[model samples]
Target chain A: MNAYIDVSWPSLLIAASLLIANLVLSAVLRLGMGRRLLVAGTRMVVQLVLLGLVLEWVFDSANGPAVLVLGLLMGVVAGVTAVRRTSIRFPAAYLDSVVVIVTTAFLVTGVSVLGILRPTPLWDPQYVIPLLGMLLGNALTGISLGLDRFLTGVLRDRTRVEGFLALGATRWEAARDEVREALRVGLIPTVNSMLVMGIVSLPGMMTGQILAGAAPGDAVRYQIMIVFMIAATVSTATFGVTMLAYGRIFTSDHRLRSAGALGIELD
Target chain B: MAPPVDQAPILTAENIGCRLDNGWIWRELDVNLAAGDRAVLTGPSGTGKSLLLRTLCGLDCPDEGRVHHRGHPVLDQDRPRFRARVMYVQQQPVLIPGTVQENLELPLRFDINAGRITGDGTAAALLSRLGKSVEFLGQRASVLSGGEGQIVGLVRALLLEPEVLLLDEPTAHLDAEATECVEKVVLEWVDAGDRAVLWTSHDQAQVQRVRRGPSIDLGSAS
Candidate 1:
């Protein structure tokens, strides 16, 4: 009835031929990616199917609490993933990640849905859940890069930092450079994406919307909103996590805490 | 120049003990550095001479004792003030990115030194004493030789005018000329009165040249 076409099972089977082509190429090149490719492809299909079913029920129920709970669960997963992506391991790192990711994702999504999108009867699963997922995913990446750079910078240039401390600098003064650099490193990815969003690539939201038969102009506007939201959330998360992390790294005595306190070994 | 034994000690370590993963590096150590004192610390490698200096400057806490400055026990809250008064210069000095003048001006920018900014004339005078012209201040720090960088670091510490200077082989990387320049500047600094120094050196000749008071041999200590 509508311009959007349904992706039936028959069409999906036809698409499966692409995987055979990939497997044949991997085998010929002896890339050792044959098994990995198959496993990953299978996992993607299974996970997406599962998510589709869960999302169906969620949308049908139209429950605000259910949507919020699901968003929070995604945030927690994102938090754990962010910490694991960084080499700096600390006892309270996961807690730091969780706080930063959850707060930024919630605030950005809340503002977008309630203030900008104004999806009727706020907390509408259709809008809230997807926006939350996108924000959480991007925020997790930014916070991870920030944390990694901050910790590694401190570790590498410890002598320079201590030199400042020895000259009577406060903890904040000693760490100012590292903190600024970390924030910059975190924001680079989102900034680069914004620079070439439409020309270099059609973003996921816009592409999906167009495939669903939405007007190009409307889809572009939504994509622009999503990018702006992501940039704000990522920067906010990076700044928040860097501030919390520096406190834990330096003690009240203005000395660098031992690696043991961070639950990691310094090589 | 012997210290005034009658005056209060500028710094004191009470039964100070330090340990490493291997075992006790030093134990039950006691020393008093009085005004105008120039004490030399000597030991073989691994005796933790630098570590001892770090502890005295409040950079490292001893496992079993405390350090005091002018009869006041050094605490966590008082560390910034304590470090300001008792400065420690490592063997290899670290310089932040900037010109020599900027490096010298850094300590003055600290909150503790807010009201005590060193005048440009003082920096010039200090640089002159170290065989550097006032124009040397404009030279980029990254381009300076190791010896020149060490001089900049020394001038920086001198501008702060700390009460006690814990020198960790400050001239280790310097040529004889540079070494003499450092010694000349430091000697003039201590001549001003009420200042003290504890320097570590393996060169007996340099020690004899610089030592105005007693030398403590940490290598022989238990």
Candidate 2:
């Protein structure tokens, strides 16, 4: 039990039998979620299985370029997910999110891998891919939360912002409060998770490592390092995306662009 | 305080235009506010009077023409300074989250107002003159009535000693007594320095009282 327990296809099928409970509940309650649950379950298995095959090849071959490309693709996906989650949107938001995510993900992960871990070859897929994956996964939520707060906040605070502008406050001066609040909101989850890191429950990364037979202390250290890296990535991406969105929302003349000009859409 | 140096108009608009989302509100409009000028911007409710005042203050862009502040392009390189020179007071006063004094003091903290105080006049003095107590400064902005908010907004702009105030029905929310007090304070403010006001009023009586210079009528616009 202390070592890794390999799960074959039959074992995976046994684990998946848990879905039967959901199906049974749906039939008994006449809940309409059965088809949705089935589709979602199918998606998860297919996506993860495909990921496993791709990850296996990259790890075995130790292909550096493939890891970089895959990491960028992950960032692109993360960026799209971040924008999609926002209830209100402006034009070219996808571009802002993608660029910010890719750059922030690379910058933070590269610092951790090169500066902290000193991984071999610097671009080693084993170290690079999973770290980028985890950072993107977390940064996605933070960036989305930040972008949504900023867009909706400026609109809601339109009068106050323009009031400042009317009296000679620069655009930055006018909107700094909203920007500060958005950053605070986006960082809340990361800060809270950090608060209860060890005492409340074991983190997912630590649990996974412990299950794979890494020493408890080693796993704990790794989790701490990764969490710190995630905080850095998330904050940086959130700030970057919010500032970019602000640039788009306020015109060069410093007027809050007409909502029509922004082509704002609601999800 | 001194007699005038250049004697240029405090604020100027040349062939300006404005547009709403659906269509043009007005176009090829020209208006100016000079020292001792008390101009009126009159239009129907939806005919773009507020937007015109915003354009003069550089808070909104003019669609077709230029705005000048004391002989310089108003919306050019140093817009904050231009805005400081030409203030816009909203019809319904907008205050930030804080006490009334805090809202008034926030704009004075801008780099444009760094060391730009005009006189020994204080916000307390202004408020008391408007029949509000010195304690009014400490009142929460959220708790202030509509007329109180308008007074705070006016006092904040006057504290900056703006050369021009693009007022959009500033007295609309005030009762007759407060409106008289606001009009007197504004008139005194204009008389005290080389300043001007571009006023908008739905009330015909206030318009008659305040119109001492040019009038911008949007009544004819279709």
TM-scores of all candidate predictions against the true structure: 0.88, 0.92
Model 2 chain A poorest 10 in a row by lDDT:
A258-267
Docking quality level of the chain pair in candidate 2: medium
Stretches off by above 4 angstroms in model 2 are A13-40, A118-121, A265-267, B1-5, B115-121
Error of 2 at B79 (Å): 0.8
Candidate no. 2 TM-score: 0.92
- Please write out the lDDT profile of model 2 over residues B100-194, one tens digit for every residue: 87887877667778776543548789988899998888899999888888899899888888888888889888899999999999998988889
lDDT tens digits, residues A227-260, model 2? Answer: 9999999999999999999898887777787677
CAPRI classification of candidate 1: medium
Q: Over the stretch A43-97, how does candidate 1's per-residue lDDT look in tens digits?
A: 9999899989989999999898888888889999998898889987686988988
Native contact recovery (fnat) for each candidate is 0.48, 0.70
Instruction: Give each prediction's root-mean-square deviation over alpha carbons.
Output: 3.6, 3.2
